[model samples]
Target chain A: MSMPALLDLYRVQARMAVQQQLQYRMRNAMVLVGFLTEPVVYLAVWTAVAKENGGSVGGWTSGTLAAYFIVWTLVRSMNVVFTPYGFEWRIRTGQMSASLLRPRHPVHYDLAYFAGSKVVWFVMWLPIAAALALLFRPTLRPEAVEVLVFVVAIVGAYLIRSLLQWLIGMVTFWTTRVGALFEIYMVAELMLSGRLVPMSLMPSWVRDVAGWLPFKWTFGFPIEVLVGDLGTRALLLGLATQAAWIAATAGLLALAWRGAVRRYSAVGN
Target chain B: MRALRLIALHLRVVAMYEMQYRMNFFLQLFQSALATGTGLVVLALVYAQVDELRGWSRPELLVVLGVFTIIGGVLESVVKPNLVRFMEEVADGRLDFVLAKPVDAQLLISIRAVRFWQAVDVLVGAVVLGVGASRLTPRPGALAVLGFAAGLLFAVVILYSFLLILATSAFWFVRVDSFVETFDGVFQAGRWPIGIYPGWLRTGLTVVVPVGFAVTVPAELLTDRSGWVTLAAEAALAAALAGLARLCWRLGLRRYGGASA
Candidate 1:
């Protein structure tokens, strides 16, 4: 497909996904409300713990902790990958055949849906985030350069997360129990991603190990830019790491897709 | 006697079905252990900052973690499979067959399917509870043990009832799949002592979702923070919610009309 033509096709797919999600407005609202409770849970715990510790524990006053978790929640909403969970079901039900018949690569169509849904969710998330900001009063002030880095990091992180999830979804072609495999990955992400706990506050061993992992780049690096005074060097380094991971994963995905197609063709459609 | 026989039959069928997936069994073991480990590590990190979290020492907090696992595991293993089956049946127009069955629909739906692999988590929880209980300098007495048992039973009832309420939403909505995920987000709060949260959030967790009653209050029973009044309150709330959930289920069923009418 030509570049402009391919872009137009993706645009149509994105529009379809957005319209489909809009049909379930009530469900989307309920889920948004439910998700809002999570940040409050974290805020409540950290606030109380900080109070008991004479207004600061592990170098975090309540305000700093609030800012970190609130931003973390927003970033989480942006980075969530839904297509991977659906990929297995799609392949099993013969839906992948239709995608395979498409002119452009299947990943573009899926990416369109993914990005489109994230846009819708980001809009839905705004009001809840505003209310949390008022209630928790998080202290988030970003410099101009840091803001630029933060935007780039969020984009890079989302791509990395989605690609890794797509790769994980390939396991569905081999086994029906993709959920079990995903759960193991999720536990690793939860512990390492700095979503469950601030990386600074984690035990030394955990922090050291998390430093070496890509999960933090997907979840933690952007928030760290806003929440901490990470210098230009570290910011650039994190962005570079994200780019490297994204490139590596995309290449792997292409190889995996070729192998999957060959295997599927050999099995008769 | 008939119910016991029915439950045993269901358990056996589940075991047989799950026995085919030995790979899944190993995956479940790894995943469940990883989950438990993550909780323990988080607790360790929290204690590294503060000696005690809201008057519960590290050992007592481990009891909370254990209760969280047991309740979550039982819900996933026993309650959730049935709930998922019920929702799918409703969606796929199979509820008519289910309704036409001679057995009571509520009882049938409640115990229809089980994922036996999650029983591994129950064992893990029991081991964690035993270790957590033993690690305390002064062990809990017989009364404390009795209270833990009562509280744990109430927690299971409350959790099951909550699942019923959520599952019953399928009667009105075309898709209510993420309700379980939302419930999970709320339930994660129970992994820690509810006492550590602020009053409003503590109240929200207690009344809105009842994670406090489900896990923390049970943990408190073992830790000696739960008084007789708290235990009584929890019992009353569980019975009330269970009643409410049954009423919700019946109303939803009436509206559903066996997915055919």
Candidate 2:
């Protein structure tokens, strides 16, 4: 009963957020272009590269590369957590102090917000993803089981992503240059997260680094699962690795939040 | 000359405003280094797979990346921040003060704010261009250099106008901060040779976003100077686009004043 009631509370908050976001509807609509643009442009460039390479590179054909980026749009939509950028304001404006007084953890609050805000972007991407599938002629032959596993991987990816972001948000307790810091972090993620190109297509060193990093788990793992590239044993290992990272990061996040809240001074001291 | 003087004065004021913040310029320096490093790394990775991407060698693509870096820096330092601020003003009905200025609103909006730190990108781009040019076989001739200068100027004009028109739409839409980011996404295509794209996307980049004229064609001019016709047409298009953006600003202004008058 408690579990069901908690879910209901989250549902109500989601509904409230959806209503609030309506005022910025046009803004969200514009943001959709960016979500679609980054991957499509990369796909086009990679497809051209593949063409020059006699139709394949790093074991990925043009069609398979196309499939990878299409899955990218969905993965990207599910990974919409930009709260780190606003953390400075929350602390500076004394919002964090009020947040600390609340019963549920701040992570739950952030998670609910992320889930709420993503609904529009998620719903809107369906038709665009469909249009891209028809245009790209991707070689997607995933089994139903693989598709289910892809969903689970994506959920795990989202947790790691948001938790890391929340930890970054905690930087406001020490410095006001969070924006600059975030920009630096963003460049690293852009490369490591397989946003720029496929990991297989990247340098061996980059693939090696990203293989052990959490950024790839957020975007790359789900796409690889959808691409149906992993064997059963590899799939289990990848998911296990992802789960391990998520657990580790969640623990780090708890420690950081404790320290951050302790340093929080609502009086601007 | 008057506009130049105004810009010089505005630059100081903007600098003073930005100086109020406790700076970590070194961190920004580090950010630029990381960004440039990552870009070079990506280029290297792509080149590692193939000898060239669509007939553009590593050095030539480095030049393309250089142009992209410069354009992004200029946009961030001047065009983008001001346009975003102008859009916010329009949304909240605070644009009248800027319109009330004696200067041209377009010029005023363009020079409104500057994050001087972004000059790092320009410096990095110049260094990259120099290194890239040093590696070109037979080097570019004097004509190629001249063509590159002309194309780069035109590219700047086209991009400024494009962004101006986009920001002006806030007069109608009233809230379009995210719209600028979409332009940013489109602009990333300029990092590569426009020819590398398929036919439809190539046309879209060239005609729709003008990233072709902005970077690739300029890079081409530097590499070979072979497309005099396209160069001339682009110069013409720059003037035409600048005029269109001026017309858009005027129309939006009229509508704005009428609604808020």
Candidate 2 residue-wise lDDT, A191-243, digit = tens: 88887787777767878888777898888888989895688887888889889
Q: Write the per-residue lDDT of candidate 2 for residues B19-38, one digit (tens) a residue.
A: 77635456666777787887
The sequence of per-residue lDDT tens digits that candidate 1 reaches over residues B1-261 is 777787788888878988998877777788789889978877777777778777888899888889889888998899988998889888878888878878788888888798888878998898888889999767888999999899999989988888889889899984788888778778888888877776777788888888766898888888887678889998998999899999998898878855454
* Number of the top lDDT candidate: 2
Candidate 1: fraction of native contacts reproduced:
0.55
Candidate 1 lDDT score at position B257: 56
Stretches > 4 Å off in candidate 2: A1-5, A21-23, A267-269, B16-24, B258-261
i-RMS values of the candidates, in order? Answer: 2.2, 1.7
Regions of model 1 farther than 4 Å from truth:
A34-39, A173-177, A265-269
- Candidate 1 chain A, poorest ten consecutive residues by summed lDDT: A260-269
